[model samples]
Target: MFRFLRGLVLPEAACEEANSSSRYENLFKKLDLNEDGRVDIAELHAGLKALGIPLGKDAEEKIFKTGDSNKDGQLDFKEFMQYLKDHEKKMKLAFRSLDKNNDGKIEASEIVQSLKILGINISEQQAEKILKSIDADGTMTVDWNEWRDHFLFNPATDIEEIIRYWKHSTVLDIGDSLTIPDEFTEEEKKSGQWWRQLLSGGVAGAVSRTGTAPLDRLKVMMQVHGSKSNKMNISSGLKQMVKEGGVRSLWRGNGVNVIKIAPETAIKFWAYEQYKKIFANEDGKIGTVERFVSGSLAGATAQTSIYPMEVLKTRLAVGKTGQYSGMFDCAKKIFKREGLKAFYKGYVPNILGIIPYAGIDLAVYEALKTAWLDHYASDSANPGVFVLLGCGTVSSTCGQLASYPLALIRTRMQAQALLEGAPQLNMVGLFQRIIANEGILGLYRGIGPNFMKVLPAVSISYVVYEKMKQNLGIA
Candidate 1:
């Protein structure tokens, strides 16, 4: 029933619990603080933390509820042993379910066939990729011992429990909106966590955008007007805005910017799902390459549909104070003066930027996450919030660096009509002008403000999402 289990392995534990009673005893003793010969919740947490197996409050409670069979508040040595024994039993059963030939070892073909029997068809190549992940020693197959060791410390009691561990991760709106949207399990859709997570992310994005609107506007201004004759540093730019509009104009187009988040997120996720289905093989599964392709296409679809808003945001961001009343007024004037095509002025460069931006962002984020889980997967594979934030920031910054010039060109295109004496330039012409006029470094005109907002925007979004999720009773 849990289709997400098709490829995923459990928490990578170091212990090799293969009917080793002494090993189990040694583990129990480490957790049984104060020599009580029984492990309490506090002692369990401390022991696990020492072993790099940090647990949230809910995870600890679930462990006690499942392992403490006598309704006692603590776990005795027997209870601890039973927990491991039961966990091992579950792992073995999963392995057996996939080892269709009853060959004691699991092959890629068996995994694909097993999942197919259960109506979750995946390709042999996809199954092989999954096989390589858990296959010890590059044997390309998983024996009982190899399968057992992969999940020795896993707290899940069954397939459902195992996948439930990943549910917490789906809500993290990591990196920027340009990064791929997190995919939800089928269970998440049925359990109603998917919509809640989206809502939480949407609200977080709104608040974070609102909080950092000034910096965003300034970045747009610097991109549009920063040149040798018109040198607009952050300080001079903000002072100019304040001088003209009395300190309130800093967030000029924030309303439109915030309004676009809900639709963009909704469309992106919807389009991703559709693309995933459309690109899936005959068995209704796709590999990593196909997945990325689908994700990039989905992002393009969303950005294309919402390109008008992009143009509006650029216009308002670079517009003079009281030039147009608001987003609607700005749109109306642009429509009258420049026709409907004006709203899609920067469409080409914006779409082109998404390819490099989403590609590198997704690539680096996956690489970093995989490296972390492979090398440092301790008691739980779930990364700490700070660790996740660090990974997201680094990958996102790298993506921005790769695609910054295109983004600058897009902004320039959007604001070209409004700029007096500005020549009409396509994406390539604008790039050439910037490089020729301001040197190569000119391609990164507003990079300072853009980078400055990323950390706080990401941090604020994360904090706000957590609070909103709690308030919405997502747990």
Candidate 2:
């Protein structure tokens, strides 16, 4: 399968210590940015960047650590050659798997078939996009020599690592509970790691929401009752809660919010995968537009499915402690008094808000991650956890800002029936009434509390999510 395997992929004694073929020297020269006899971490990363091969922080770090066997913080030519030789067998096996039909070359169709098996759908054009990166002779496919040469310095030993190195951004948790469901490889799904990931995410989300429940409650209160006549800023809002029901009342509605995380996470994950499968282009590639569409649709599907919980969360958040004993009492009262449809009180605006929020969130996160990589990638592979948290926070905040007006409307509509003498408004009527009565600023009434909770929520979610993933063996 690897008929053109270079001498560099041979035993170290034979390829490096015994010989100086131009091929090995040329490859080493590509990685030796300072023209020294060895390659350092920065040079390795820069060299890979120059090759148009992008890798994530973890992948880049792994390559460097594994290759620098002497603990010297650098790779001499011999170490470089030895590392390549050790990894060549694995890379060769990966190539053979891609070279379906045993043709000794990887074609676009093969790429399509291979990825489909891995649960990723890409079009022929997308597959060619992959090939064009590795295809040197313009043959529209990759031969053994092309494959080996392209990946000789790459740290990925298997197809999966290669996929990870190329398909970035899904790396860090970013602390956004509303993030699109992460893509899982077919192997992970089969091994049952998918559930562990979802569980970790759900636990993280639950912890985060609970930690910020008071702020969330305040935000809901502000959205439902904040007005020109009754100015309920954070200070007054919090003080009112303590006066009415004491400190514990701040977490009045958090139980239901925490309870709904599991189902919502699972639904989103499953729906995202299904939507990707359905919307993929001819080459099994999901384009930017297609991905956004799938993600939005997946988000909507999950939101719609768990919408009852949204109504519950809103109702509980705005209610006084003595008004409803707990989530079950609140739900039972609503079901009996308002009928089945009460659970979907604000379905319209809630669904409408998903597109802009998901789209902006995805776009901003990508831009920030890309910008970070461009400016500081050579300095260090890992951007550090705080950097990731910052990116996620800004992106999610932007999303909330873009969609907050609609969110406020949804919360109000969901809680409206509980308020005496409140106007019953559809999505449009709510918009008109809010603008007319509360002014443009009223639409952002609860935004202070909502934003106030973001940093802590993000920090808690990120920490808990990482710990959970580690405990669950979700590498």
Candidate 3:
């Protein structure tokens, strides 16, 4: 069941691993700039960076020496293979180091002692929780097989690579949310076919937005008018939209919504990479906090760049019949009548919301991923699709919970003028009105529809993104 779930949620990694050896060979060839049969220190350094493994100078030198078994100052195929073999051996020794008394299995007590030596400062209960995950026999002890399978699949030998991969691949319950690293791999960067990443992201965004357009439209309506109209709900909102503009009204703002996805995603991706470069350490690796900061800044940059489209989208959605023919008309009318400030009505809340939503979402996801790795993952590097789904669901749920009120306020602010009889409320004024008129719960108006969209949206985006990458021949 676990294997099945993993295959479902993380098929990309599973399917891609089958061709990993070939991919590695191809990667090696790409790194061999001079077409030499052996790889020198310079070539190896370049190759690791190309593979997204950024080592500091000393670390790089150490890796080179480790691989050059014959003291040849470079790595031949034999030496390279030996180095790979040695990495596995070193990891096995790490496992043994945890098993005190030369025992074949590790108990919770052993875990506590080992973690203490590393200054982890965990309680025995926490140690037991960690052991419980890989305790296949339910004896509350991790046997040789369990220990080996749990840590052996990871390929990084050096601490830098280990921490980097751990930060990227596993989620850590680090109390607060941080950013998830970019999904693109080093091989994808080396391919110089960058458009594929943008294409995949754009397609994923489009598909998610389009598929959930109706719910989105409904949510907008509810946010703007639900407090005034107590009868408003999902079904009534749908009926109201159809009555106002016809069944097609459900997608009134979809054009602008879809239009902004490509550039937004591309810009965010680029900004994120640049930010990563900026935040990276001497080893060319970034910590989780750095990743979160980079991601938040990137999101803010993308949001600011494409904010006008968001305004246009909201206007189109909230517009009454004959108010505007299309998004262009809506944009033109807003610019001409309301001026430039109109396009930025909800900009502050929107930007502010990104921090909590992205931060909490990222943090929770990393925490969940870390917990699963600590507990359930053995043999398989991935905990599986179900685990991914759980992480996303929980993270998104928490993020939405934290940011929903702000989002509601932003939506109301954006569409305030569109509703003829509605009062114009600034950020603080809007919060006051909502609280006084409809109570705190009013702040969560239309959240049901909003929450309903999360699962399908995330699933579609992830699955489509992966499929598109494969179809585009991205490594």
Candidate 4:
């Protein structure tokens, strides 16, 4: 594993530094950016800048004069070798200086102090974030081996480059592949990036839900009209929608759907991050079970917060054209007629569904991620796109399947108040009524449309999410 990480970071550093014939080759290649096998003063300056080493012109000139034995303004292999020896000696001294306690490791405070000396002002939080990246043993400190391996190839130290390399490093077997991106340190949770993460999640959710809006409308129609005179099958449902309000009708209720997604995703993501912190162990590691619990709680919290939008969405989907003009109008009518309880009509079943839905979803996804990592990504850390899609689709499907019946019940309860002469039923009464009227299979009335939408919806969602992160330079 150590050798694998070294290869990813410094592919040429195979042999130990104690008895290596070509120890300076990787260093030389880094300095020789054009790969001309020679290090010019310009290349050296750029290399030092990349390494976060601020060398003044005079200091650079001094090194160039000492290393350029041939006096050709460039250092050949042998000349570069001499420079490399001096560079390592300097780095060793610097590392020792930072190891203030002489414990052969750099702690967060020590690193912060060293950075301050270099005119870099960083909080202890930032210091720990940096150390945690290189801390291989979970000790939250950088050992000599880790320190040397990290700086072996003279990796970039600028914040932008650091983030990029950190993400790139995930593609290599530097260590475990289960590092949760959403799991935040105490410091990072309060950082500006927290808001950015929430915003990204909101955008991803909106895009995914909107992309699947047609099928979502179909699902609602099937759930409500499957047993009515409409006899809503997918084909009939689509036809009925177009007949009613044209192609645009296919996206009925999508406005509320899209609006609800932003807050739902942002709340869920933020809550999940917080819950993970609360549930994490002393080591600050959250296990799979804890993750599932956190996800379930987060889902429920988000659902409860935006549940009125869900109710409004359902009413608009099943309502006739003259029934409600928009989401606000729908909410106004529901509140005026049925009071506040109308907005939470299906609160029982909706909240109930979160348990199985979130539990199964998270459990299945984590299991699949672990399986892919163990089976295929054991050799290479990052799995292929197809693997991720397969896992996401299957896991989401299984989760939806487990909770679909409850979701159908919730939808029915939410829309029940809108149907004239239909009795308002409690959770148990609704279950019995569905069973008596449409049989047990009635609970899964819209399942086909729901299933049909899962793959594409989840695929697009994940794809957009990844692209967004990459674009934002977060990934």
Report model 1's TM-score to 2 decimal places.
0.73
The sequence of per-residue lDDT tens digits that candidate 4 reaches over residues 217-295 is: 8899899778845577989888888888788777779888877756766677778778888998885666556766776
TM per candidate comes to 0.73, 0.71, 0.66, 0.66
**lDDT tens per residue, model 3, 206-228:** 88778888888888888888975
Candidate 1 structure quality by residue, lDDT tens digits, 25-62: 76777777799899999998888776655656666876
Clashing pairs in 1: none
Clashes within 3 Å, all models in order: 0, 10, 8, 0
- Model 1 stretches astray by more than 4 angstroms: 1-54, 60-176, 370-383
2 versus 3: better TM-score goes to: 2
User: What range of 10 consecutive residues in model 3 has the weakest lDDT sum?
Assistant: 169-178
Candidate 2 overall Cα lDDT vs. reference? 0.76
Error of 3 at 135 (Å): 15
Which pairs of residues collide in candidate 2? 121-284, 121-285, 122-283, 122-284, 122-285, 123-282, 123-283, 123-284, 123-285, 124-283
**Residue-wise lDDT of candidate 2 within 79-170, one digit each (tens)?**
88777777777888999989889989999899878865654455676666677767766798887767876676667667865764333233
Which stretches in model 4 have alpha-carbon errors above 4 Å? 1-26, 30-182, 185-191, 228-230, 277-285
> Residue 119 of candidate 4: its Cα lDDT?
25
Stretch of 10 with least lDDT, candidate 2: 1-10
Lowest lDDT 10-residue stretch of candidate 1: 1-10
Model 3: colliding residue pairs = 6-384, 6-385, 9-385, 133-375, 171-366, 171-370, 172-366, 177-363
